[model samples]
Target chain A: MTVDFNAIPLSQLSIGSSCRIGEIGLNGLLRRRIQDLGITPGTTVECLRRGPSGDPTAYVVRGTTIALRKEDAYQINVFPI
Target chain B: MSITTEKDFLQELNKEAETIRLSYVTKLGDRIIADIYKNAEQISKNVILNDTNKKNWTLKLDNYLTSKIFGYPFMLLVLGIILWITISGANLPSDMLATALFSLQEILSRGFLDLGAPAWLHGILVFGVFHSVAWVVSVMLPPMAIFFPLFTLLEDLGYLPRVAFNLDNLFKKAKTCGKQSLTMCMGFGCNAAGVVACRIIDSPRERLIAVLTNNFVPCNGRFPILIAIGTIFGVGALTGQLQALAVAGIITGVILIGVFVTFAVSWILSRSILKGEASSMVLELPPYRRPKIASVVYRSIIDRTIFVLKRAVSVAAPAGAIIWIVANTYIGEISILNHLAGWLNPFAQAIGMDGYILLAFILGLPANEIVFPILIMSYISSGTMIELESLAELRLLFIDHGWTWLTAVNVMLFTLLHWPCGTTLLTTHKETGSKKWTLAAFIIPTTVAFTVCFILTQTVRLLGLG
Candidate 1:
């Protein structure tokens, strides 16, 4: 398997930051659901803002704002651009 | 190291391995997904043109809408405004419908008498069946005709997904998927559909949680009662837009209570019976679009308003006939309807509601829209009955029947919390394919409704406030 040692989970990306998605460590249904939402390897995601409860954060990707919860976001590795 | 050889690895795995080796196969699937996306990007670069400025406007509106600071307040304001519009706008039309329909009832009864129809037949057909259906229509149709279109307009504008986005975390705290909020919104239109919408949740446990708690949100059938009572009580001193705003605020407060109860029940269910996997929350906020007015109006009127009205009228007509019979038939002196209310009075009063109201809810099991009609029939359908003319008359009738503010408050709470209507229960049984789950869905909300009202009634009585 190819691993990017420097890549951090998308959940760690600060608000107003942009990054290129790296290897998604999630498997099976969770991985497939994310893939269906248009988040794939090398895709770019920009952190918009956190929800009032500070768990799910909204992001701009593929011309839409998709809310992703922290745990799910944590599985998707991203390279800071 | 790389040559630990594919052939050697394959031979070892083929001969000795008990489980299938799928690590490489999984990686290959991921590679294929990535390749597809990459190829799509390549094609889009050549064919798709840029329109950064057009996209920026939607993004800009969303900045405040999805922002933590303004999100909650904006949600309340938008909802309040929509409701205010519905309330004030429906008043005239509802009155017109009542006058038009009630007058027709008089003509129908007179015509039946002229045609040499038997008095018993006149009583059942004209006064019992047709009267009740007419009441449901006059009271229900105008508001629905107004409310559904406005709601559908928001839905068509793609604003509802953003609402789901805003409330995702709150639902997360309750251990259900954010998409439950979307189903709950659908529930505001109808709960039967909302239970069906629960299929969108991937995990079984979360789906059940959504289904069970869907009743906490009042459906369209209950909204008119909520709106009417809120306006009558809260709009006492205010006039014009201020009155509308006050009424809307009260309705919004009721909705907030409903939401709070939904969260609390979801929290309990997740920890207790429905506990299992963590909920999966993923919501796509589609770009806001210019809504097509013609399509929005057509769909809302045809699909929501007419469909719901038809169901309510069908049930109400028969229920009205039964109620008329019970109210008319005497067992010694008091009528059967009164006898039943008398029997139920002790328990109903204990819950901060009267026996007639309780009986109405029971008889209205098939359709919540007819609860008001049944209640009216119970209270005044005898010889001294007068036509329901306006809010003032309705208020006077309630006050005559011992309805204080506390009674009003408890009635709203019960309406918000009670068991799902017959259609919703049937839908739940079908969706879950389990009678146990269907019974749980019924038992859970009912228990919640009775307990909440009981505590409130007891507390108020103990304090001597009411």
Candidate 2:
């Protein structure tokens, strides 16, 4: 079944848990860029750090550390395992 | 429960159960994955829904401004508008300031004479120091006053992220972090601040690239020199409606050229001296917020405009006074100002600028704003050592000395591409914590400036245009 990552709050995911990024609902370059970073469907992601701003959070995806603004991060649908 | 010692019986039982157990394991995995997906979805949805409720008009505005398509264009347009407004608006105040300050110079000169002050005192105080300071203020103040507020408004609006986005790809291609663009933007106001801003870029190699190239973007202090050259060299070519417009356009073009060269040199450095993979940049475009106009104006004018002006003035005033004294104080034959200019003359000629102009540039190294004043001191004191109150008179004086379009173009190029001033150099040294990089910063731009001027002067002379 197709599931949206936006349905769950990122804060609910404990650090070190692995998840698969589905769709990043953001439109345009930000969406394309996230997908390019291997935050695509079936890719494994691990929460690395929460930023002070409570946005611009970081995650490890496809062997690379990436930071996403909370807004865009919300748009991304990730299936956790 | 068949015993493994009865190998035949165990193998038969294992085969029968394997197919059934495999299905169970697959089902369990899917169920766990599904549950996790549902949780992440719920978390993200709840936060966004809450955000929508709390944020009102301000948040909406921020979103629009920081939207991918609109953000980059908006930032560029705002920057262009600020430059346009500054150039157009500053002209009136600048002329008035020059008129007012020069009149004061005359009054001071008369007061010194009336007080029966020695010729040397009058020369040092009125002709040397006061003239230089007055010239610096008249030329440097207005644009800075106008430009800083507009720039700060963008910063407060949180549009800088979008700027970083637009330039990220180019930086990535250079094998540098995209965050370097933000540092470069910071450099526009001041290279030192830009160097500090480099802390945002995580990779050591990329951060150094940003630091070394920060000075390529001219700061507030250097605007006076550029404006002077633009007004004199480029403006003279056109007539009527085109004249003023042409000047502003050329200056903008020159600034754009500086940005382009910044990227080019950065690319070269990243690929060669700082060889590394392109650091991944996943920048989040912050939602734009409503810019606070009143605060922007206050901070930009008081915090940045006035602050930079104060620094420039403080350094310039003493330099001016010293230059004036040197010009007036005779040592046997030529005054100190003349002797210094004479010494620099040969080297200056090779670089397409004269000795006096080059000397001014060196003396003005403490603060770029003082360059014009130093140049004026050298010129005025080279002869009668009288303080002129009007830009018209200053122009006439330059005309008397045979300054043409070539000199103006060369000056503008040199100003744009020279080494960072003493303060910026120190900032670079401190930021990098390395004398080697600091020296490289100085040498790279100086070399570029020399090469550009040499080619330009040669081309002009070859065309018989000079």
Candidate 3:
């Protein structure tokens, strides 16, 4: 697990940085949805860009861009790589 | 018990069961998903060589397209360019089509008369049905043919998911899914297709919200009307290329209004009858690929353009005949259309449109492409007997009927916000499979259209602009 002292919420990860997902705190639907899209523990996600309105930030996971809102991304714990 | 109360009871029961089932799914998903990926990765490792050195250009392009500063401007520019092309390209073909079809109509009428067809038959079939249907075909076919292909190309190129990413925040604020934006893009082609596209949304509540609010965006049927009005009222003084560009911008602004209203309406629904927490949004931005020219052309032209055209033509045929009957049949020297218009005038005028305009909208319920033609026919048969071709002439006709800028503005707004066409309503019913939701779909937009137009017209009239 990457859930050592370096863990932080995925939403706080800076743009252009990469991270490995430590733990997902979301329950039910969101957890299933994230996992369904290949976002599992130890998966690498690179922060790409934030949208114009800046609520949902896009990240590259498994070579695909997936957008996550702050509230949702806050539930995902990651370690900066 | 009442249906809604029964539904509430059912939902309450389902909530308990749903939580348990979902918990099981989540528990099962963790290990199951991990294993599947592990197996896939192992297989790929054994059988396939990984390409690590992908070119940076696609990545750089994605950054430019989705970056905070560049995202909106690029989206706007792309939309502007597409609309610019649709506007400029559609005009010449539409005029050519109009000329060709009207000539066909003349020949048809001549043959019908030579066959010694009754005057009423000639009137009903030739002047009535053929005229309006021709109007619909001429006006509708070109813009759709041009717009759908371009939209399909962008969609094929996978830019639409970026659009959803770009607008996800605004939609989230409305408590709806980001995928609603993608469906709204489909609505630009046709609302019926838009309703079907709502299936992309996983949550039932959000999907219904999307289907209901999809009509808020102007479809291809309403684009010409907006372009015409925007040209006349917005950039009336501008000439040539400048006029087209200004009209394109004006249209983009009007569509923006629709987007805002979508947020407002979606928010209202989520808070009210369709209340629920926003569902999981996992939008996949697939790597942009080169859109195949042959497939894009085939799908856009055949699947979208022809599909929508068939719906419009089938509806317009009967509607054109009904229009003829109503225009011809009179009580006390007033045609039924005029009577209906006059009856509707007080209410329509309250919302800044007049009798004939409102009547045309009602008749246009079947297919929106025929609304302007119906309005023109009503005006021409009631007032004069001139054949109108160009938007300039259409503007003169509206002005001739005492149309102010307020009327033009309200007409465009009403077109943007009115009820979906009949086929779309039927589609909503089929999709939702509930009469209540379909009825809700109809009532929500219609109510919004009236309220918004009423408020605007009253404010403008108070300002003495009318």
Candidate 4:
């Protein structure tokens, strides 16, 4: 099976870009937690801002602001809407 | 209809869910959200475009607040300003209250003498109970009055979630929910409250981690001690505004250390017994609004300030009386207080604290607000509480008792990292419902306090830095 090489991780999305979440690459508790926060596949997420360290970026998801570390964000595949 | 027990029904539901593909749950969630959005779009038209621009302004402000270059510095500056305001504003009122209370003590003592009452009775009632309560009020009330309102103002303006947002990565790295930052903020007000606030975290493991570490942050009762010591030893050399700023900075540093320890302990717990994956959180940063002054004052003063003060006073009163009894009651020409202090001296010395300080902490277990009073009572050998008029006199008193900068540093560190008070421990017990976990909560911070102080003391002594 060939991977979708053009599908970028959510962490790479520039500020102000709106995108739809694709397959979440994490499983178990982390996956459940992400879904519980309404970041399921096909949901729209907008990149908001980076923190002082520029690693943890905030995103707008389901009318709430959620922050995710770049490492965790890397596991979330998304494409610009 | 057949009767089905709740547990059996839940088990049946779980089995049914398990039979389906796991990805179905994700699909179901997506479908639910998508349908909701579809319904919303059908009912509301052009709402997004109109509000989007207006909301983006707030989002833009949030961007700046949480920006890479400005977020942390801005947070620190705000914290420093709050501390500075509390310190400077509290000083005059505290002094005034002390004067008024002490004068009332003088009047009451003279009245007792005139009524031919015994000196011991007067000492216990007036000096031990009344003085301790008065000291707590005067020392704690002003700062709480100023600090709580300001904190409430920030809360009303919805800045706290931003704080949690900024600290989210740090807490996540510790394998806990980012919401723990908000709970820790509550801990700065009261650890028991913080313990209760941990309920906001949905994951049981993360909630437990939060409950155990809530005591790292000094509560309002401990703030007086931090400020007093920070003022005297940490910044006593400075003058005027700079002095207050330095003191605030020192307290801020102490608070930062507490935050650091919270993270460290949370990380250790997650990697060890409470090991688990961190649960993600979607924190809603509510749009900032102008805080209503009336509600801010009422809620902060009536709800927070008075509530906390009442709790502190309830414990402090009884602890004060007990401290007096210990200081006055003699065992072979040495008061019990001194005897106990003497017994703890070797260990305390190794940690750069004295027996009296250690004993004060032990006696102060009920309420931290009374620790300074207990120390003063023991130090003076007066069998009654005393409040010095000025920081200079307080410094001289400590110096006369052989307190150096190392002692001050160790005391501050110990105070910052010591065991949770009786109330916090009780709250932990209630929250965790496990004697073992509550014991862990008690022991963890106590152990950290001793180890930190020991290392700092030994290092300073070995390096001849002190």
Candidate 5:
């Protein structure tokens, strides 16, 4: 089944969860930077930590730390670990 | 349904597919995997995806930056505009700061005299150390203030990622990470910051490549010396509109050299130290947004300019005082600075610079911005140097010190390629978590600087330009 990510809270997602990155649903550079960090379809990512503001979150994928805004993080679809 | 048998067969097939995927990932081949994943999904969905001929905006943007036709010229033009803004805006404030700071020097000198201090003490404290610090502050502050902000605005504007996107193919071909270009952008603000930015690359090998190549981007601290010399020698050659344009051309040429060395060093490191296949990168092109002007100014001025200035000042003030004392204090017949400069002269000449300039670079390694101040201190304290505050006066000072075209070219080259600052060194150590790589960072640029300058100076002298 195609996973629907809109139902889940982005902040609640755990670290190391494999997910499909979706296209940006909002306007901003930080949004697309998240996608550029390999949050695309079938690309598995591991969430690292919440940044200081707790909106633009940090994650590890392909061994890089990529920070994402909270609004942008929701566009990503993930299946729980 | 023979559940156990069916499940076992499915697991076996899945494991085989997994092995193939793992192999591709190890090869850093993201595109093939992406294609596979996309095709597999299409097959499973039972959809006829014949309409997939359309290219997306993201793909189109990537092609523009990475296109062989547009890439190099685009890079140069963008870099030129940034340099023009930095140079033009820096002029007024640099003059103002020098005037104010030198005026304070006069006040301090009078105060020292009024306190009944001896002439030698007054000379050492006021004329020697204070004047040097003032010169450093006045010259360093404006360029940094202007340059770092423009750079940060670009960063905040999300233009940097596109730059990385454009340069990624080159880096990948060199067996380095695409993100190395991003780190190079950071190096414009400071090499240490660039080193710290290397964390975005996942592979240890590629990260090391990024670290070693970071010094090729001339940092904010090094800008003052390069600009001064470029203006003096390059522009001084011509009069009228031609002079201004020539000076701009010289600065641009020097920057292009730094970038060329960055690519060369990255290529060398990848082939020798960290041999591997090129990685396929999937970068997203963010929609362009209107830059928040206030935020850019606030963050750039406060976050970058003030922060960097504070750090430079903290380290530079003491170094300024020490250089002053060195230049003024006599040992037997020669002052300490003269002796040191004399000692360094042969080696400096071999690299197309004099001992005093080389000494300034060595001392200024702590902060690239301080080289001008150190150089000024050496001259002012050693000889009967003028205490004027204008760029006009500053130009006279360089002319007085026997600065030739060769000296200017060497200074620009050295500024463009040298060891990263102390902060960058420490940051590289932290990011790479390896002392070996950090040492490589220092050695690569210092060696390159010496070789390039040696060739340049010799060539110039051979042609009788020197």
Candidate 6:
């Protein structure tokens, strides 16, 4: 079996980077919410900007701007496209 | 088990799915989304990049608005300018309306006397009901007229969604919806409407949280009190444009405190009994367009201004009659209003406000537009409502009642933080479909108001600053 270890958490992606979500590591309503916002695996998301606090970052997903806190973003695995 | 009936087979399948759901939601979600994308890619046409030429100037402007460095300052500047416009523009029209309405009240009183109507009948109909309505119109209409159109203009121009985008993070930290900010802005026009606006939030838990905390944003009714107190105590020393700017700035600061309380209470509720995880939101920042002035005027005036005014007047009329009766009817040597106020006085004083102010708040529950008038009436022991000509006269009225700067500050604070008016309570009840949640909404802000005022008063007194 081959292991692909280059995938990183969405929170680690820098501004202006476009990536496809690899895996969602959240559960239940939180997972459903992210998916509902079109941040599901295989969907392309572009990093917009961090908030003034820099913990919550905004990403443009499926033609809408969505904000994710660091903890939530960490649960989503993404790979640069 | 293999040859079971259809119902049993379905039940077994559901049990299987539930266990699988608990363990592999992440892997399952990834596979499903990947399959969806794969299917879409097969059916779609050639994709094009570099679509900037088709994007209009609105997108370029959005880049600045949603930019980290420029967004917060720009939001504040726009808000400050709107508030400044409201404060300065509302003055002349409010005074003119007051003069016009009061004169009409005098004429109506004289006409009733000439028509052989008894004094008590005249008092109940003209002085009680009519006076309250008059006060509501004079105090409320101008600000709403000015503020609502400006707010709607922003909404129409598509900046409001950007507001939701900017505040989304803070609200997410509080475990509520970012759309709550838009509803809170709606609250500035009318809290009942704001409570109704909670429908936009899809998550039921976050919607309830938004509904419960909407009262932290002061509505049009309370804005009169805030503006008056702000002008008198907050920035009264300044003159001309400086005074107006100072008042606007102070009101904005008070509003910021209200927003803080909203966040704090939301955070507490989300962590406590109403506990839940924050849900993600997909906010589409709509493109900016030129706001149509005609529709802006019509919608703001007809839909918001008149609609809110009508609701307030309906509640205020009955409240006025009750207030009149309370002020006129004596228990022992004191009028019932005074007796009630006196009963509440000790606690009120401990919070830096006197009994009459507290009593006014209690009686003014129907509509907050009349709290100021009721206070003035109680202070002068007038059986009917009264209005002074200017802020200076209003200041003297308060001073005569032993009010200090401490009282003024606390009154403004209490006014801003207290429970929703009667209409908002009803709206909450309807929205939540539970009496228990409505009761919680009422109790929460009232408790916060009392606690905040008590702490401020005690701290000031203990430090001998008051």
| Interface DockQ per candidate | 0.66, 0.10, 0.71, 0.42, 0.03, 0.41
Ranking by TM-score: 1, 3, 4, 6, 2, 5
lDDT of 1 by residue, B1-466 (tens): 4666888998887865533445766677778988888888889889999788767877888888878788889988888888888888887888898899889999997899899998878888877898888888887888888888988998998888888888888888788888888899899889998899999988888999999999998998999889878876657677777887888889899999999999999999988988865656777877788899999999999988889998988888888888888889999999999999999999999999999999999988898988888898889955576887888888888898899999999999999999899999999999999999999999999999999999999999999998
Candidate whose lDDT is highest: 3
lDDT of 5 by residue, B43-129 (tens): 756854433223244335434643557755777777877787777777788888887887788799889989999987787667655
Candidate 2 fraction of reference contacts recovered: 0.15
Worst 10 residues of 2 chain B by lDDT: B50-59
Off by over 4 Å in 3: A1-3, B1-29, B46-55
> What TM-score does candidate 5 get on C-alpha atoms?
0.74
Q: Which of 5 and 6 is ahead in lDDT?
A: 6
Runs off by more than 4 Å, candidate 4: A1-9, A21-43, A61-64, A69-78, B1-17, B21-33, B46-54, B382-387
Which candidate should be chosen as best, given DockQ against the real structure?
3
lDDT of 4 by residue, B155-244 (tens): 998889888878887888899988898998899889999999999997899999999999998999999999999999988779878888
Q: TM-score (0 to 1) for chain A, all models?
A: 0.90, 0.77, 0.94, 0.91, 0.60, 0.93
Docking class of 2: incorrect
Q: Is candidate 2 or candidate 4 better by lDDT?
A: 4
lDDT of 2 by residue, B370-449 (tens): 88777876777656666465445666777777687788778888999988898989988998999999999888888888
lDDT digits (tens) for residues B1-466 of candidate 6: 4656878989999999988886786666667866775765555535635344434566577678867788888888888889899988888898898899889998999999999998788888887788878878888888899999999999999899888877888898899888999999999998999999999998899999999999999999999999998898877688768888998898888898999999999999999978999876656655577899999999999999999889888888888888878888888888898888989999999999999999999888888888987887778764334556688888877787898899999999999999899889998999999999999999999999999999999999999999
A1-81 in candidate 6: lDDT tens per residue? 455598999999998899988878886777777776667667899997776546467788765567776777888889987
Docking quality class, candidate 3: medium
* Model 6 spans with C-alpha error above 4 angstroms: A1-6, A21-43, A61-64, B1-13, B17-59, B383-387
What local lDDT does model 3 show for residue B71?
88
Residue B463 of candidate 1: its Cα lDDT?
100
Judged by whole-model lDDT over C-alpha atoms, candidate 3 comes out at: 0.88
Range of the 10 consecutive residues with the lowest summed lDDT in candidate 5 chain B: B50-59
Q: Model 4 lDDT vs. the true structure? A: 0.87
CA displacement after TM-score superposition, residue B105 of candidate 4 (Å): 1.1
